[model samples]
Target: MELVTDQHKKKAKTILKWLITAGIGCLFLFLFFILSLWGFAKIQGPPPIKVPQTTRIYDANHYLIGKVEHENQNRTWVHMDDISKSLVNATLSIEDKRFYQHHGFDLKRLAGAVLADVKSFSKQQGASTITMQYARNLYLDHEKTWMRKLTEALYTMRLEMNYSKDQILEGYLNTIYYGHGAYGIEAAAKYYFNKNADELTLSEASLLAGIPKGPSYYSPYHNFKRAKQRQKIVLQSMVNNGYITKQAANSAFHAPIRLVHKHKPMNRTAPYFQDAVESVLQNQLHIDQKTLAAGGLKVYTTLNSNMQKKAEYWVKQVINPASDIQTAVIAMNPQNGAVEAMVGGRDYHKSSYNRAVQAMRSPGSSFKPFLYYAALRNGFTPSTTLRSEPTTFTYNKGKSKYAPSNFGGYYANGPITLAQALALSDNIYAVKAHLSIGMDQLVKTARKVGIKAPLADIPSLALGSQPVSVLEMAKGYSAFANGGARVTPHYITKIVNQKGETIYEWHPKKEQVLNKAATFVLSQLMTGVFDKKLNGYSKVTGASIAHILTHKVAGKSGSTAADSWMIGFTPRLVSAVWVGYDKGQSISTYPDSGYAKKIWAHFTESALEGQPKNSFKPPKGVVRRLVDPKNGKLAAKGCPNARYTYYLKGTAPNEYSHRCYKEKGPENGRKKHKGFFNRWFHWFH
Candidate 1:
């Protein structure tokens, strides 16, 4: 019996030893599997937690104008400390009760969830920890495929190995979509409760905590009863997790909750200005729309709010709301090329096509400034005379006979000074000057002055027949306003990242492109459009709105069959306005024809109201001479139509007009010409 007992003890010892050895081997295999997963996750790099932040836009005064709306990522990141404590507690209690205790996965809950899913013969029961869900949101798509799940698991492991529990929690709260185009807790709080995340009450916290499970299914905006039921479940979970007492949970569940009205947020102020800024960002800065939307950059624009408001106001006040006639206005600072105000269309909501920068219409006489400036560069003073008559010009080696008639067929019938031609917008005089200077030279000069639109080297171009945008016209005229320094139009002045680092800042450099004397001479000649004294066969083109000028303004008015344009500038500001139909329909209505001038006059006056009345100062190389408008000669005593005309220092007329003195002979060795056309045309050839 003793021998049998000893043998039994030895057999039991052997069995026990084998059992311990097998258990140890199984434990080692499990550790090896976990280490393999950890290695793979490490090789996959850190988890993606970069959240798309909201990009803000400001005016020149640093006042918030609006925020750029990226797809559905209406998120504003806040620190964990800025979130309500109750929200954190409620979220953790409902989302992952063992979030603090586990590294990334909770085995017990995962086992229970697997068993339940197996019993139900489906994968409906979820065992995702907050870290796992965050990984899924950040890295993988929400497809229920096993590959996505496995990828999510790897990312979850990566996040746990790299970031702290607090970091994971904060990122999770900030990135989760909460429906209604709201991403993150802060935007959700604002959309649902009309309050900030830090200001949420216990009831609000529990209510928001229940939304992430199925945002659309449990949204209070979609189904309040279901959302309340889910909120009750979240409150009970908090109670069970010891985050709140049962009595406290009950009180929170019954607390009165106020929800904001369900509507799309209307926080944007200047829609057209915002669109223009985006255009500059894409076209000039080379920042694509997708990156700009998600970059979280704070853009500071050169927009003056007061000027923008006045521009819009005048546009609305001028054009009838019932008509289809559209108007575009642009007010820019000529000193720096900063676009202070922009009105793209009469109504932006109806049509977003920006006429200010997009629509290319015939500039008519508005383009004559560039033509006359080119003439000035080619040794033509403001007092230079051209025969303004109805004449057919033989061009293309007599193959093309171009006949450009004056407006209403009213011409000087003899000769008119360059200033009077500009004031009356004489087509014949413009064509002669354009042909005399060589057509291609005018195109080059226009481009040099910042006119980027394609120009045709034709005789009609002299009469402002080329199609150009209002913005290009404004930029072209900026050189004249700023004393010959060319400037590029700029909207955004600075761009800063979310980290308060400046990514871009505009330091405008003035490239001197035009002759200072020529630009000044042309600028002063432009003022003749308002002077009734320069009116010859017809009144000055700007005569109708001349009474509205409160200060010195040099500008021109242009009219085509389909388009009407008024471009002018003071020393500080240049405004270009265009009024026409979207489809090229001739402006037949009297009111429609006058819209450009009215809008320009009102907006310019209002914009310069509180500012100094600055006058255009002539450059050093320019000389002022009192000259006769009828003939390109120096004024003598008792001259009928003598006015101060600007000229390049050496180009002022030395020969006194025969009308001044009854004698027509050589004076001071200056021989008198036989005929005006014979001598002037001879010199031109």
Candidate 2:
């Protein structure tokens, strides 16, 4: 028995010796592998550190309109000096008590976390130091796997070796995600307290420190009671870490915290406009999405806040909220083509479709001015008479016949002058003119004045049968208001980079596309829509809203089955208003038919409130003469209805009205009826 026991002991001792040798060898191999990784990390610096930031937008007056962010990551980086001490201390206490003492990994906390995770049979415990967390945030995905952990461990060592303690902490604070679309401490401060990071109080700091643990659950905006409980735990941790006294910790926990009002969280005052500006930045400017998100570029737009407010107000006041009718309003500067105000739809939250730039609807009779401009350029005068009776004409070499009637099926049934036809929005006269000038000339004329939408060379084009956007109409009308200088509609006027250098600037694109003298005569004739004396068989299209005019304005009104448009302009500003259903439903003729005119009147009056009532200045060689609109003949004292009519130099008729009597004047009173330009232009010279 003694011999057997000795043999067993010898075998056990031999096995123990071999096991010890193998264990020592494995430990040495592991150490060598770690050292090799450390050496490799030294040669490879950190990956590019690009933190997402917020791009702020401002109006023409430099007032903040809203902010733009990428993927809801709203972050604004700040220096360590800008952060409050309380926030830093509270964060450190709850997150890592030995943040400064440890290099990268804390063995004591790791051991405890491992033991707890083993006992609970789960991998829910975390022992990441600030440096380790920072590395994970910057470089690695947050997937709890063995491979990811090993990668994270390698990155942690690299961060500790390359950066100082303060650098690591600053990066951690800026890159961490908070609740409610806020990605950094500064953004959290602004979103929660409506204040800056340096202005946070002790209670506010504690409240914010508790959010990073579970942003959605501990958000005060989500659950106040849970947020308060988390704040108390943070305060207790601060006291235990010796960063704050017990008395101060208790006081902060019991103090009342005020959060920002839960209203307008997105700050989207003009969401549609913001979207249009972003599209221009991406598509037109060729700016990539990634650069736009983090480039910190400042976009200065031409939006007038006062005008925008008025546009929105009038739209709401005029259109009933319960109705499904959608409306779009666009106002621009006639001289520069700056888009002063824009409303895409009735409500932005309900729908984001921008009708001003998107919806393509017919402009109705408001498109007559473009046709008339084409006529004037082709040697057609305002006194040119056309038969207004309903008639069918054969075109396409006798292959097509088109017959159009005036509104309400009422026409003069006789020859009518162009001025009276335009004032009444006569369809037959426009069709006659469209066919007389050849269908292609109107298309060329429309394109020359900035109408970008495709127009068909057909007789129906004369009555505004082609669909176009409100913005296009506004842009086309700006030419007439600015004496035929075509302008391009644009939102952004300048863009500045983070280095305070201007990268883009806009200069007015004023191309002279129409004859100045002809345009001046056309503008004067357009105002006949409001003149009652020119009314013959039909009321002027603008007669319903003429009493609301506080300034000298010239414009046209148009409508189709599904659309109603009132587009007009002054010397300084031009606006186009449209009301219709999205599904192309026929609008009622009574109240729904009148919404566009009312909105236009109110918005135009409000937008031009503080400005002067400036009149359109006629370019040289344009002349005005008093003549009867009924017959387009030279006016005499015996004429029943006489008014001042504008015409190109030498285009005025020399023959007197038949109602005239023999007068004691020079050359049968022909010299007494000279054009206004004959006196005004020569006198100035």
Candidate 3:
């Protein structure tokens, strides 16, 4: 029995020994297979995917625009130039000490890490080398299992063999997520210091190097204490590894952490305009999103950044704050429709709704000028005053009433000259003038003068009750800009690609809107609004400062209960500004003229600071004369009501067509009698 048992035990030992030997052999074969497969993978290489090219935004002048970053997604790209060697060394020391010296599977490190873990583990054991981390990031899970370990090792070997060191470094830096919407070192630097990564200090580099292990936990924005602690670890590792001196490491560790302010995108300034330009360029010109975002495109835009800034500032400070105010501003070169600036909102961040290009607010009194323009085409000289008193008309719907009241409260009765009616913004005068002149004619005249909105057939249409864009109003006013020539605001002057080839070029075309004579009379009459009706500004008056401010200038003010707007221009430069809230309601305690005028003053003052004031040159077609403003006829000497007026050179007044007429010459036109309505509407006149 003893012999039998001993024999069995011996046989079992021998069999087990053989099995163990075979198992060892099988293990070696498996490891060998893995190595060979990994070697093959090294050659085959990981596939390279095209990262979404970052898009860069720029100012209107075509300078570098900021980048568009994605939140919680890898949206940044960094290069070797943006990282420091010390950062690399520090990361390696605390992560895996034998990173550079080993193959993918560092057996020695595994054993050491395990031993340390068993001895005293604070948290996760450090068995992952930089290459292993990269491999895990590219492909694999962070599971604590032998299978995951083996796969990570295999992938690491593949990564090391497939990619160049620089490429690996770039990918690692760029793909690694940093908390606070930062993806790469460059972005992090911009977020932390308002600068680029290449400009970071040694302390900053060390602080950032510590973020990857636990981004959110170590973020300076949310967990400053943890971030500082992590930074200390990184600094200590750097010093111990001789990447940095003890003094440097201590200095870095002691440095205060500073987080950067939010970078509100510059893409916001003229979102609608930019959208229009980019869409046109992309659709019509075939430009792609990649080139638009990161190609360092120098888009020489028609926008005047300063004026645009002023317009936006005004809307924000003076308009949007009002509960119900909404406004828009569009300044263009009337000679060629190049829009200088367009501001659509008070707070773009809060809401992207654009009011400038998209809103449809009623024009109110602003539409009245088109009627006068039509009347001029009908042979009514501005010197020909009709009446300023309240009057009712039956038009539009026969049953509906058309009674427009002057916002100034009262009106002048019959015999009020055309010049006086306009200076007072008389609704009755405009209604009568347009009714006699013809509504269809008024619509055509308004269109020719740049009013692009659909007009009502009713008499109210003559008073600017139609909704119009600030851009359209600016163009309408431009009839006086270049002697009746049209101005159309357009963006995207030129579009180029990465190769610098012009994909598209915009050459603005200015057309004739009104004849020189009509334009001249309107301009002169428009300028007269400043005399006394708009007088008493110790230093400023919209009528006087907008037109004849040491130079030939002219403009008009428009206001609706919900919005306040002003469009003014000099012969050399024309600037139109609008101010109000996003929602169209009565936001102003008073009216828009005051606020709009002030904003206009601010914009014009800054924009026209250095340029020589310009004067309007009456087109060769205008005739000039001085006459009794009471009637469109010649006035007598010592006539207190005399006023200067312009007529088209070929269409001068019949009474004064022989020569230039001045008020000083001629017999007494009529017995001068002071009128009652003039007391308030035209106090000084």
Candidate 4:
């Protein structure tokens, strides 16, 4: 009996020793895990929370015109005060019932979730509080792994320690994705209900609050029935949490939630202009696309909505939708170079290629004015005679030859005054003038007036063989209208940051690049292109349409086999229009009275409707003289054909004709010239 009791006592002692060892090992393991968790929490501070914002663009009147959104992340941050109380209550009830009581995680919910998962034999339950979800959203990936969860927990603790409860809620609401390209509560509200967050009703709030759980599964836009089911669950949760009465929950669940039936895609106003502005900002400010997409910029442009509408209307009216032809128009304040209106194409939705600034097409005879301006600066008068007969020339040491002819092969074939040559758009005369003035001088003149296209020294450049954009042409013509002052075309007038601080403002730089007197003389000569009756010639050029309006204007018309252009200006506005196929096909089937001139005339007339009509004021150092149209010489009173011609002060005709000054008898009918010089001049007369 003694031996059996001793053995029992020994067995009991061994069992107690084994139990103590197991407890010590378990305690050591717990201590090590706690230490490691503390170290990790200390090391990992917080996660980066990116609240993607949309960049907005406004017109001159400060109306929202367009928005640039980040890929799949359209967010608009709203204050907690602006958020609906119903949405907040619903979110708290569904996501975390004991959010206010917990520090970073709910210990009771965690234990319950663990027990439930163990019972189910799978990780099927989540115990994440609002703070923990926010931490995971901002800092850690949503991976079902131990390391990710540990990091998420550490971030949650840091978030709870640093931010208040309201801040945490705001962050979670703003960072959560509600599907359909919406990344914030404000965006989601706008996307689903077409209203702001503060304006959401109880039904709408519950529906939106339930979306974040499984955006794809609960999106009202995608699956209305599923979304309604989830919304009912949220309403029940709100009722169970005592946030709302059972009666209110029942009313919400039974209420007809009017989900927006047709989701209206964001409509872009003046998309081409917006594209040009974006390109300008990117290039001039050295702004990256990423930075631009993460927007907070307030760009003020020079677009006149009224004028833009007019331009767009005229573009549609002139071009048939079935035709392959495309058109571009640009209008500007000639005095300041502000681009008031621009239409890059007929439909910006089909294509975004900005024809006004990007397309480089030949200007045709529209380029003649630049050559004439150069000639005028080189001591050539409007009355200076040039042989307009068809001609040819050899260049490049006789390796190349050019023989340009007049349109329709209709040549004057005689001495024609500079004014008549320009009015008729004589190709031979233009090439002759370009050659006489030197190609280098012509290119320099073109450059001074804002033609940025590369122009070769070839003679065809006089006829606009080189490709130039409509914007460049507008700027070049603006120099003529602005009295020879070169203008740099620009759209953005000012830019403000999100903080309401001015970050950029435009200060125009005007340079007087052409002689004022010469420009006036050149402009006066171009006016003859629009004259109803020039001595014996009838109005036949593109400027003939300008004669319909009472406003005084000067312009030129140009056409190639494939392109047509009209660039004109008044004292206030300068506009340019181009029409052609996108692939540079022949538009020769269309007449000179085609889309280009018609659109230009209609748009210019509409743009200048309410504005004052101002005439071009001639500068000093210009002289007017009466010359015989037949001979381009000083006119006598008895001369049958005579008109006033413009010339620089010292460049007018120095010789007078006495052949027509003599009185004639009725029998003789006309006076006869006896002198050799008079007879010689009589041949041309």
Error of 1 at 205 (Å): 33
TM-score of 2: 0.66
User: What is candidate 3's CA lDDT for residue 498?
Assistant: 46
- Which one wins by lDDT: 2 or 3? 2
lDDT of 2 at 170: 91
lDDT of 3 at 218: 85
* Model 3: number of backbone collisions: 25
The clash count for each model shown is 0, 0, 25, 0
lDDT of 3 at 399: 80
**lDDT, model 4, position 559:** 91
The digit string of per-residue lDDT tens for model 3 on 425-464 reads: 6677778888888778878877776676887677877677
Tens digit per residue, CA lDDT, model 4, 338-357: 99889998876566689999
lDDT of 1 by residue, 151-207 (tens): 778889999888889999999998787765577899988989988899999999999
lDDT of every model, 2 decimals: 0.85, 0.85, 0.66, 0.81
Evaluation by lDDT, superior candidate among 1 and 3: 1
Off by over 4 Å in 3: 1-62, 65-276, 282-291, 294-296, 312-324, 396-399, 449-451, 533-550, 591-593, 630-642, 650-685
User: What TM-score does structure 1 among the candidates reach?
Assistant: 0.66
